[model samples]
Target: MKIKVLGCSAGIGDSRRTSCCLLDADILLDVGTGAGELSLEGLIGINHVFLTHAHLDHAGLLPLVADAAGRFRDRPVIVHALAETVAALRECMFNWRLWPDYAALPSLERPFLRYEAVEVGATLSLGGRKITPLPARHAVPAVGYWIDSGQASLALSGDTTLCEEFWDALSRIENLKYLLIETAFLNADAALAAVAGHMTADLLAAGLSRLRRPVEVYVTHLEPGWEDRIMAEIGAACAGFDVRRLRQGMEFEF
Candidate 1:
C-alpha cells in the first residue's frame, strides 16, 4: 500500500497544515486542511475516511469534503471513528449549526454521509489492506492506526502522549517498517505536553525507550513556530534511533 502525507503539522501556519494522510486513493486517514489542496476529482474519489479524533485540526474539513463530493457519489461516504468521536461530531460539528448534517442531508434513507463506530484492537480489512485501531492517550477519545499491507506495516500515532499500551502494541507488529509518532512540543514545554495530551522530545524519547521494534521512526506534529527547536531536542534525545521529522507531501510505500 502507498500512503501520502497530506499534512503533518500540529498547528497550521507558514504553509503548514494539520494532520491528514491519503492512503492509496480512496482512503483518508484524517481529513484536515491538507485535504483542501485536493482537486474535486480527488475529493470525490475518497470513499472512506478513518479519523483519529474529533479535534478540529484533524477532522474539521470532513464535512466540506463530503458536501463537495457526496452528491456525485453512488453511495454515502463511510466514516470510521470511535463511538465517542462520532458522538462528538454529531453533537458539536454536524448539528446544522456549526455545519450541515450531512449524515441526514437530503434524506435519512439515503444520506451523503454515514458513521461507523470502531474500537481499539479491532482490525478492519479493506480489499488487500488491513487497518487496526491502536490505543492512544489524548485530550479526547482518540486512537492511532496500524495499516498493514501483508508485507509490511506503517503505524501512525494520532495526537497522543506517552502510553505503554501503545508501545506494547508496536512490539507485536512483527512487520512494522515505519512508525509515524507525534512530538508536539519542545522539551521546555514538557509540562504543557503532559497536560495537553501531547508529547515533547523528552517524553518521546521515553516512549521510544519502551519500543524494541527496529522500525524507522518519523516524528510528527511539531508546533508551527517551534519546529526547529522541537526537532533539535528530538535529535539530541533520540540519538540512538533513526528518527526523522515528518514532512507534508512525503509518501511511503509498504
Candidate 2:
C-alpha cells in the first residue's frame, strides 16, 4: 500500500492545510482542504473514506467530494467512521442546512454517499488490504488506524493525547514500519494540550517511552507558524527516538 500525505497541520495557512491523506488513490484517510489539490479525475477515483473524527479541519471538504464526483460514479462513496463521528457529520455538515444531504439525495436507495459505522479494534478487509481502528483519546470521539498490506504495516494515530490503549495496539503490530502520530503543541502548552486532548513534546516523549519496538516515526498536526519552535522542543525532548516532521506530498509504500 502507498499512502500519500496531502495535509498534516494543526491549522490551515497559505501553504499549510489541515489533516488529510490519500491511501493508494482510492481511500482517503481524512478529507480536509488538502483534497482540493486533486483534479476532477483524481477526485472521481476515490471510492472510500475513513474518517478519524468529525472536526472541520479533518473532514470539511468531504461534501465537495461527493458533489464533484458522485454523479459520475455508479456507487456512493462509502464513509467508514465511528458511530459518534457519523452522527456529528449528519447533524452538522450533511444535514441539508450546511450542505446537501448527499446520503439521501437523488433518492435513498441511490444516494451519492453512504455511512458505515466502525468500532475500535474491528478489522475491515478490502481487496487485499486490511484496516483496523485503534483507540484514541481526544476531546471528541475519535480513532486511529492501522493499515496492513501483509508485507508491512503503517499505524496512524489520528489526533490524540496520551492514551495507553493506542500504544498497546502499536506494540502488537509485528509488521509495523511507519507510525504517523500527532504532536500538536509544544512543551509550553502542555496544560492547553491536556485540555484540548492534543499532544505536547513532553507528552509525546512519555507516549513514545511506552512503545518498546522501534519504528520510523513522523510527527504531524503541528500548528503553522509555531512548527519550528515546537519541533525544536520535540527534538530536544525526543532525541532518543527516530522522529521527523511529516511533510505534505510525502508518500509511504509498505
Candidate 3:
C-alpha cells in the first residue's frame, strides 16, 4: 500500500496543514485541511474517508470534498467513522446551517455522501486492504486506524492523549511496520498539552517506553513554531528508538 502524508501539522499556518493522509488513491485517512493540497482530480478519485475525530482540524474539509466532487462521481463518498463522531458531524458540521447536508443533498435516495458507523475493534476489508479502527482518547469521540495491505501494516494514532487502551491495541498487531503517532506540543507546554488532549515530547517518550516491540516511529501533529523544539526534545528523551518527524507529501510503501 502507498501511504501519503497530505498534512501533519497540529494547526494551520503558512504551509502547515492539519492532519490528512491518503492511502493509495481512493482512501482518505482524515479529511483535514491538508486535503486541500490535492488537485480536483485527486479529490474526485477518493471513494472513502475514514475520520479519526470530529475536530475541525481532522475533518474540516469534508464538506468541501463532497461539494467539489459530488457532481463528478457516480456514487456517494463513503465516510466511515465512530457513531458518536458521525452524530457530531451531522449535528454540528453538515446541519444545513454550517454547511449543506450532502448526506441528504440532491436526494435522500441518492445523496452525495454516506456515513458508516464503525466500532473500535471492527475490521473492514476494502478490496484487499484491511482497515481496523483502534481506540483513542481525545476531546471528542475518536479513533485511529490500523491499515494492513496484506504485506505490511501501518498504525496511525489519531489525535489523542496518554491512553493505555491505545497502546494495548497497538501491541497486538503482528505485522506492524510503521507507527505514525502525534506529539502536538513541546515539554514546556505539558500542562496545556494534557488539557488539550495532546502529547508533549516527554509524554510521547514515556508512552514509547510501554511498547513491547520496536517499530519505525514517526512523530506527527507538531504545533507550528515549536516543531524544532519538540523534535529536539523527542530526540533527547526518546533515545531508545528512532523517531522522525512526519512531513507533508512524504510517502510510505508498506
Q: Which lDDT values do the candidates have, in the order given?
A: 0.92, 0.92, 0.91
Error of 2 at 101 (Å): 1.1
Model 3, position 145, has a per-residue lDDT of 94
Residues 1-254, candidate 1, lDDT per residue (tens digit)?
89999899887877999889999999999988888878899999998999999998899899899989987898889999999999999999999899889899878988889999999999999998999999999999999999999999999999899988999999999999999999998888778888899998888888889998888999888889999998999989999999998999899998
lDDT of 2 by residue, 1-254 (tens): 89999999988878898888999989999898888888899899999999999998889999998899988998899999999999999999998899988999888998989999999999999898999999999999999999999999999999899999999999999998999999998788888888888998888888889997999999999988999998999899999899999999999999
Residue 181 CA displacement from its true place in model 1, Å? 0.5
TM-score of candidate 1 versus the correct structure, residues matched by position: 0.98
TM per prediction: 0.98, 0.98, 0.98
Q: Candidate 3 on 114-191: residue-level lDDT in tens?
A: 999999989999999999999988877889999999888999999998878888888888888899999998888888
Indicate the worst ten consecutive residues by lDDT in candidate 2.
186-195
Candidate 3 global CA lDDT score? 0.91
